[model samples]
Target: MNPGVHAGTRGTPLTPTGLSRPSVRSAGLLLGLALLAAATALSLSVGTRHIPLDQVWSALVAPSGTESDGIVRELRLPRTLIGIAVGAALGLGGAVMQTLTRNPLADPGLLGVNAGASAAVVTAIGVLGITSFTGYLWFALAGAALAATAVHALGGARSATPVRLALAGTAVNAALFGYVNGLQLGNLNTLDEMRHWSVGTLARRDPALLLTVAPLLVAGALLALALARPLGALALGEDQARALGTDLRRTRVLAVLALTLLCGGATAVCGPIGFVGLMIPHAARAFCGPDPRWLFPFCALYAPVLLLVSDVIGRIVVPPSEIEVGTVTAFLGGLLFVHLVRRRKVARL
Candidate 1:
């Protein structure tokens, strides 16, 4: 197996660690789920108003039309749920993109997904006068799909290599981002909306929009999970995959479709929150190894932990005002990436 791409955390468990591979993976998975649950509680309880655990629980079990119930049921509940959904989507999307591209640094944004979404949102606000989250959602998905399709076409379709695909995506990302900048500069209203959305906050979210995108994330997640075996086979190299009777074309197409749906839906809802996808897979690999079957589940559980922790931290770090989840994750994930590079765990792709 290619250690860099296919096998992370490669080693036999030592007695000193008090765990075998299966045990370690199981522990990690359990811990991740527990953390997610705790974070969800914290998210519901520790917002600007600071509803107590008891109050949050009361609001959940029995709604009395009180202020606490409104905060718990109407406001924080949706935000927390959206955070979980978006976090899971981004984490899985990043893992899928990196494995398919064989690039440890590959993130959902690397494929122009975020840029395309941004361009669409900016265009909608500026040209179409659409100023609602619901309006942005559909536009973002369409743009992301179009951008991914363009990248695949430019990368040579069935013959595209991961390097070529990445390069094409980078080019498309730059062009779309440039176009987004032009749109923002030309319109004051667009600039204001873009500035807020670009920072990526789960605040002021439309529950309906979140509900609308949930199916896309679910579909994409199922597709990504289904491709685990194919991706594992592909990690062995194209010739080896072909020799093993894997269909490379089918795999790539489905993989791209998965990324587009996951990343697009996430961007549409959360406005391009960064780093959840970039950091979760590598972290999961460090604990459980590089098998996608294990990695995907770990990511699905652990990513919401990271996100909710960040969201909670963002709420508390500044008191009256809060930091954006995107900013917090970007800083933390960038630091991790740098540490990995300095440790030589990540090589040039």
Candidate 2:
């Protein structure tokens, strides 16, 4: 065993390098906060118009009806705020999902949350003639909850293992997404409306929309944080966690609920932005080890950094046209996922 690495649950060397110490974990968390701040600043400053940092700050603090102020207050601020919220939700959700499944590669989507949200959104636009974000938000949440609940039932609620849950979720995801695709293909109007949204960009999100979903996301975040200890115990294996008095069924149920709230709200707002939930946990693990106590907070803070930075990149990559943030993350995350698989042995939880 390397001196710098510490054994985690099941004697796995989960901590990389010198991050095993509490002080180091705290420092890493602070660093994540700094990165988030920088990402927020960049999201505000770097856009098609390229407002200076000072001007961005000025616009935020004191709006003077200038073009910059209008752009900052009306446009970038909402986008940035939504980005932060969505990013945090995805990141925290991913971490919890991965921990619950004991699979480092697992993401929130593995539970059918994204697919469920997408199917509902497609239905909203195609069948219900609902085009507004606010109108479809509740439908998205209901769909996600139903899908996850069905997954749990299929997985045998009481006897559900990680593998069983994953398989059930995959089945549900396939079915729902297939339905979504067919509906979209059959209706050009629905397809046109969904084209931009399905690609997952944070552009033109209303602040009021964020406010509407804020409570749900915040509740989900709190629930995820609360599950850290139980998840950590579960990572040690079911028998061990049970021996330690952890109620596996209750924990799993709550975890699913938390994920539904987190991923559901995020998908409702941003239309299934990929890779933040998939990638941020892995990055946070390298710095905070496998302990959900540390990893969750790190993911919560730094995930927004990845999301906001990607949004900024999207804005500048194609002049005025700009790539969608989801497109950028998918491209980057695909490469990173490949690298993670090929470069090192996948960590076992």
Candidate 3:
């Protein structure tokens, strides 16, 4: 057996032309980028009014102040940009999370991060009467950090297994979301404000909100990328990872911090879009063979493709009315979840 080659579930070396070969992985990355570009174009062009690609390009380059220009520039462009940023954050966060936990089912939401953010945002709206995205952003970050910390403590940080952490996260997720529901049910204003947000649409978000959250997303992305090598080492097993000079404590700490920033910022701006994190990493692993270096970038590119395509579909699926992107993803992710549960080979990390 070659020390350089990682083995898949059946002990097959994961270096075939279709798998972990550097050339093939690089080509896959390019293909992902191409797909993302097409998704972005479709997102801009396939909205309620169905603007043409020429007009979309013109709106970007030279705006004539037409309704099409308003739709393209004011609405779709910001939505597309937010989708890209949030999708990349969720994708990279999910890859890091699954690697850190050594769990195939790990995602940002699995650890209660999204629930914490939602609960905090609801608190801000209902209790504090804070209506600004910036305010929600701060509360969301705080809640995510607190929830992750609680999960770490409850899971027995020094001796936590993947199962223990997952159980702890599940407990915390249920509790926080229950609290969120209670607040929404008690306050009509909160419920009204959270109606669309809870469903997770990319519509009606202010462009300024993107500017506010950009730094957090970039920082989280950089941190997640930097953890790739250490996380890959950790994936080999804790004893082996320690032998290879991986700092388990520091790695876990940074990974959690990165998850908080990425998940919190995304939930803040877009209101907790699901399944992008869960599905994209698995899809990337199919092509990249679980190497975090390749897997992270591939997830980043392809997650937005899934998200934007879902948003476009949500727009056109019904007549003038549209479904939320979250609803679309939830339906799709539910199918994928069923398939994963039935297929043992794909479900193991």
Give the per-residue Cα lDDT of candidate 2 at 102: 91
265 Cα displacement, candidate 3 (Å): 0.7
lDDT, candidate 1, 274-308, per-residue tens: 88898888889877889988998888888888888
Instruction: Name the regions of candidate 1 deviating beyond 4 angstroms.
Output: 1-16, 339-349
Q: List RMSD in Å for every model shown.
A: 4.0, 3.5, 4.0
On TM-score, the stronger of 1 and 3 is 1
Model 3 CA deviation exceeding 4 Å by range: 1-20, 336-349
RMSD of 1: 4.0
Which one wins by lDDT: 2 or 3?
A: 2
Q: How well does each candidate superpose onto the true structure, as a TM-score?
A: 0.93, 0.93, 0.90
The lDDT, on a scale of 0 to 1, for candidate 2 is: 0.89
